[model samples]
Target chain A: MYWEKDIETIPREKLEALQLARLKESVAKASSSVFYGDLFRKIGLDPNDITTLEDVRKIPFTTKDDLRDHWPYGFLAVPKDDLVRMHSSSGTTGRATVIFHTLNDINEWTNIVARSMYMTGMRRSDVFQNIMTYGLFTGGLGFHYGAEKVGALIIPAGSGNSKRQIQLMQDFGTTAIHIIPSYALHLSSVFEEMGVDPKSDTQLAIAFLGAEPHSEKTREKIEQFYGLKAYNSYGLSEMDGPGVAFECPYQNGMHVWEDNFILEVVDPDTLEPVADGDGGELVMTTLLREGMPILRYRTKDLTRIIPGPCECGRTHRRIERIKGRTDDMLILKGVNIFPIQIEKKLMDIPGVGTNFLIVLEREGFNDLMIVKVEVQKEFFSGDLKQLEGLRRRIVEDLKSDILITPKVELVEPGTLPKSEGKAVRVIDNREE
Target chain B: MIAYQLSIFAEDKPGRLAKVTGILKKGKINLRAITISTSDTFGVINVLVDDPEGARSILEEAGLTVSMKEVIAVVIEDRPGGLDRLVQLLLENGINVGNAYGFVLESRKKAVFVVDVGDQLEKTQRVLKEASLETLDAKALSAIEPFHYMNY
Candidate 1:
């Protein structure tokens, strides 16, 4: 019943052997790329350098900056004609990062996602409706081809038009869906607006949620709203899209297909490997990709390798959900917030006091930023409406600047705790 | 002249309101009327005290953010539409009431409505005086206890 079950549950040593062999091959392939060729030539290195998995750290990290600086086809290891398909980031953050795939790479990626879907109970009898955006986004076409490979009845219903989406579900007896978490919530609300109860009205039973990092609470909310089991799939455009890691039936942690990628959890600050189960940055090396054999790519996604065996018996090591991304700035839900961003925004407002405390809390699968702003004495009045208006203005101002809606609490001056050392600015309470 | 109330900025938490009252009690300040205006995170405790200047310094020295704010006190009818008449008059004059509270001085004839008229304090006083509405200054308010006439 398992897709490449032997490889999935292969003994640790055999998997390591396979990884080592493939890693060497991947390195040889990557050296053909302009970026890696230049890097290897300058360092006087060869594919034989990665004899052991530990030797991976010896290789320089391929960062997003390295990818962007090189631009369009710099990371492509094969000939330009070999690439049949590509997926890209929206470039909303900055310049877009594009991943090229050869036909064989497409087959390989399709096979893994097929395997991922199969492992989660998708079969030929199921009607799979892709409810994500198509074109450029890997999530859409990734699952489309994977579900096709599974021999499922496919409806390429690519995103939005919520009413038609629900109609397609009821009309076709759709049993499976690949959707984004936030959109899932939005569709669920539409279902309520139409007075259509998903639990009884639709034939849907399974759902796959991905694209953005969401909370367990958010998943549970969707599950309750739909009366269906929702799964979280993790991937990035840099890693050739959405089938990189997936939650098994147990729903404990995601089994990162160890056969296809080597996983490394390193402390973000020290850049040293953390002990197993310790929270750190997730660095990945693609072993099977041919067009782009990215080695020791610093994903910047913070998660830990789940310690101990999963009940599903897949030998591939599991990884916790992404905690957050670390850069010189903070990437909260893919949006970068700088240390001075809040203070800078506050400076523009007339009545904001000098002292402010930023508290980051996890609110139901979301990062909640509560800015406890010390109310300026001149602004403080016994008038409730005026104070509330100030709070709303502060919220709107910060939202425009940082793109995160923060709850601005009007606190009295001298109430916030004093620090003896460097000024304490932020308090992050998000779980690792 | 505009009367004053000791406005203490307070955080909304257990025992925070107690701390403000404790300082006022220890300083032996008698309150004429008290009203707490709150937002999500904080509240302002506004008390028309027998001694506003004394209470402000006491609270300030106790590490509290305290201010003696201007409030206009007017004696109105202690009846159902007593507040409505005064409010309608102020609304017609374009005087916004930022904060307000009241207490009775007589059974049905006289009750004092204390209001923080913000920037329009002087204008509100002139409007009320022209309307022949009697207002209690700091001296008149602190001098009388309404319950002193009732012994039950």
Candidate 2:
């Protein structure tokens, strides 16, 4: 249930020694990996130059586009024969990027994930229903192995079908449920409709929500409504899925699994590393990845490292809540709008349906942002004037809610295209 | 009997509804049947009251968007075809129904149809009354029951 070394309670000097030792070993392994070896040689920096954990950042940073540009098998560190299982990232715009896992790598990932679960105060006796989709994406399998590793009975309940999920929760006496925050809120609304208060009816003690950025306002609201301790977990397909770091009981921030991943904060614009307490882009170097070891991967996620020991006694470093990304994807009307921000605002509106899309277009040099939201049946009525008024109200609400004004187009339910994979939230029609 | 109908426009935020109702309460206009149809922009609340003209005055004086109309209330069978048959009568009599809404009075074993006709209001009323249909006045309609959806 814990690492061999007392990472949470270790002396500061000892922890630094462990990090340095792991950093040296990681650099040696990186030099042998064909991908890193070639890239390091091109940059004229030998892997031997990385003697300390701090020296690891002197090497060039890796990015998702790095894996994408490399394509199918370019980033593989180990031979295909050594891989026990494979997982891929759900690249929305292009072809999926794959990650290979050797048996030891899987064990390390699971142990880290199990430690994450334990850090959140979950027990081995607790039954977990992993609602994350278990397919090409690593969320399902990563949590699956980790929960089983923690010795918990897992339901393996992939996302969707809220009615069935509720039934399973009631029948199985499920103590823990893992899902994205939006879906969890949708399920809470269903629970309210069924005249069943989920907080009291079921025995859900803790809920892990991630794979997306959610605000603290929403976190508190979800916790209040569901009556469960909700913790945030951050990860990506490049870093081996959603157990990179997890929030503990204090809920101050998530504790990064330092033994596996080395965390860093860098100035988003300059790409230069920042101080501990300052907010910047998070750059992670996988210290113990086998299938695809990423060296100084530019995650583009905005958060800083929390220095000093946490009140929960976990010496593992904590990361601040993610603020925003730095990519130049879409800048409409001077508003830095991410799809996740709009989704969070929409979820807060009572009676708004699940499906929505942010349509971005350019007409005669003017940027037009339209939010195509699905209107549920209850919102429809025999009165016309009231319906017209509600239309205007929803537009104003969204404008004030997200701080970005959008033309709210109320379409019929199921009008928007639903995704079997990662839901495509933004549609930019501007010419590339 | 003549019944009055009032259409009031209010902002679609939470406390705005309470303010509108508070004005009506102070004016002592009893609201019988009311339905608030909502869209993304605004809410249109249609109300049948004991004193529509008075309600209109009170709402307008309070700077609310208000309108008064002469709507005919016809009592018909509560079952399905009762409304279809009445619509046939209006069409057969050359009365064009512009906008309409209905509600069932379960205790009275009847459904009340509120109709806004196109320039044939008198003829529509005469034809319905001749067919032994009872018309409800604003006072009687408003005294029946208060609207709950608009408030809660």
Candidate 3:
């Protein structure tokens, strides 16, 4: 019943052999690219140098800055005519990183995504509504082609427009949905507003939640609210997105497809490998990528490898859900935001005092950002409307920069907690 | 004549009220009436203090956001319809009371009604003057003695 049972249930020894073979090929393919070509040459490495899986450690880890520093095409392995598509992350931090794919690469990504979807009991007879955005973001098109490959009657219902999405679901009898966990919980209220109970009114039996890490309690709430089995989908744009790893029906953790990639968890600070089941940063190397073969790319996502084998019996190793990031980047409503961006925006506005705090909280399935700013004594004009106008300005200006509206609060100068060394500017009260 | 009241901006939390009261107590500020208006996270502490400017400066020294607003202190009868008559006058004149509080001055004979008419303070004062109603200035309000009805 497995989608790729022969490969999925392969023994560990055989899996390692497949990985070693693919890794060598990938290394040879990657040498054609400028970034890896120089790095390999600088280290005096040949494509045939790596013989065993342990030898993978000889290559240094690739960071996000490496991709950004290379800019547009430093990582492109093939010629310009061979590229079929490229997906970019938002330039929220500084520069955007692009992932290029050939037609074969797209087909491989689509197949892996389809295999992931099919393992969750999705059938060709089912109707699938994909609610993620279809543009540059990987979550949308990654699953779009996968669900299509599964032969499900698919709806490419891009993000937003909650009412129309529900109407389409009811009309088409959509049984499965691919949505972010936060949005799924928020859309439930809209369902209640329209007086439509999703459980009885429509055929929504399966959901795949990705784009952001959520608590198990939140997952259970979504599962209970939708009357469906919710699966956690983990992926990154650096490694062809959504098909990188995914949760089986067991939902214990996500099984990474080792046939396509090599996985390692290492301590972020020391950059040394941790024992299996120990929490650390995940480093990946693309084994089957033809366009851009990334070697030992540091994913920065913190998770552990589940020690024992899974009951589903897929030889692919399972990794725990992302716990946190090695950096201070925040993911709110599927957007990557840095605290420095908020600070810069605050500095540009007049009358905003020092020591602003970003308080992120999860309130009833919604991620709430409350920006607390101190009001100078001179700015208080004995009128509530004046303060309200100031607050509205902060909220509006920040929405343009971050792509989401945040609640602005005015506090006294010395009211906020002040620390000695870093002056903790952000306090995240979101529970796990 | 215009009367003054202190409106302090404060976050809604325990001990916030106590902090403001502590500052006023040290500044020897006496209050006639007090009310709080809140919206979810923060609130405004409105107090009809005898020394509005003095209380504002001292609260500012304590690092609290304090502002002074002009309010009309009306002297209404302590009877049942006394407050309603003043309210009807306000309604007839199309005036909105943004914040208000009342306290008995001489028991059944007289009481003080403190109303913050916001931008319509001048309009409300003109309406009260036309109706021949008694209004108090800053000096008169600050000089009022509320417990004069009780001799004990």
Q: Which prediction has the highest TM-score against the true structure? A: 3
Off by over 4 Å in 2: A1-5, A91-95, A328-432, B1-152
Task: Point out the worst 10-residue segment of candidate 1 chain B by lDDT.
Answer: B143-152
What is the lDDT of every predicted structure here? 0.83, 0.75, 0.87
When summed lDDT is taken over every stretch of 10 residues in candidate 3 chain A, the lowest stretch is A88-97
Error of 3 at A307 (Å): 3.4
Q: Report how far off residue A256 is in candidate 2 (Å).
A: 0.7
If you score just chain A, what TM-score does every candidate get? 0.78, 0.76, 0.91
TM-score of the second chain of model 3 compared to its true counterpart: 0.93
Q: What level of docking quality does candidate 3 show? A: acceptable
Q: Supply candidate 3's per-residue lDDT for B78.
A: 91
The full ranking of all candidates by DockQ, starting with the best, is: 1, 3, 2
Query: Per-residue alpha-carbon lDDT of model 1 for B1-79, expressed as tens digits?
Result: 6788878777788888899889889999888899887888878788898888888888888877776778898888889
lDDT for residue A228 in candidate 2, whole number 0-100: 92
lDDT tens digits by residue: candidate 1, A1-432: 688889888999999999999998999999999999999999988888888977887788888889878888899899989889887755223355788999988998898899999988999999999998788778889999999999999999998799999999999999999987767877877898899999999988899988877889888988898988888888887787888999989988899998889899988899889998999999999998999888888988889998998888899999998877775345454344665667777867876777888888766445678999877776665566767788899999888766668988988877777634555478878643
lDDT per residue for candidate 2 within A1-432, as digits (tens), equals 343348766766777778777777777676766777888788888767877667876888887777868776677777879889878765232334677888988998998888888878777899999987787678888999999988889999897788899989999989998887767767877788778777789999899988756778768877998899999988877788878988988999998878787788989889887876889999988878777778888878888888788887767889987776776334453233456656666777765677888887655434578887765545544345444555567777767644546787765456478844566467877432
lDDT of 1 at A260: 88
Pairs of residues clashing in candidate 3: none
Cα miss at A53, model 3 (Å)? 2.0
Interface RMSD of each: 1.7, 10.1, 1.6
**Candidate number with the higher lDDT (1 or 2):** 1
